[model samples]
Target: MPVAVGPYGQAQPSCFDRVKMGFMMGFAVGMAAGAMFGTFSCLRIGMRGRELMGGVGKTMMQSGGTFGTFMAIGMGIRC
Candidate 1:
């Protein structure tokens, strides 16, 4: 997204754009958090090998989706 000169050079982004940006940012953060939490939880539960990978992956996806949805809604509000 490029900014323009003064006086309405660049128009406001659409709702979809805002939501997309928010979702992406949230997903990045969520995945990091999920990875840490999932890794620890699985290890604490004595999970290993494929089971640990699956658990971490599942947790990451769920957290990413949850965060993305909330961030999208929050950004889309635009007020």
Candidate 2:
């Protein structure tokens, strides 16, 4: 009688797999950083609940402005 082997295989990742992995890693890192900074800023400002939410909103608005400027610059460069 022949012994059966456990299922095991290795394969190289394709470009699509690489892109998927990269996106997942980036999303996880961004979430972690956002949580840390949001909490820290709120604590530093002595905010709670609604106040913390407001602080987050303000930060998001500021981030939007910065992101917009950078995106515009990148677009200009590409054009």
Which ten contiguous residues of candidate 1 have the minimum total lDDT?
Answer: 1-10
Once model 1 is optimally superposed onto the true structure by TM-score, how far is the C-alpha of residue 28 displaced, in angstroms?
A: 1.1
Question: Given candidate 2, what's the lDDT at residue 31?
Answer: 50
Q: Score residue 64 of candidate 2 by CA lDDT.
A: 49
Q: What is the C-alpha lDDT profile of model 1 across 10-61, one tens digit per residue?
A: 6766678888999999988888889999999999999999999999999998
lDDT of 2 by residue, 1-79 (tens): 4433445644545545555555455545545555567778898979998989877766655554554445445444543
List the candidate 1 regions with Cα displacement exceeding 4 Å: 1-8
Model 2, residue 54: C-alpha shift (Å)? 0.4
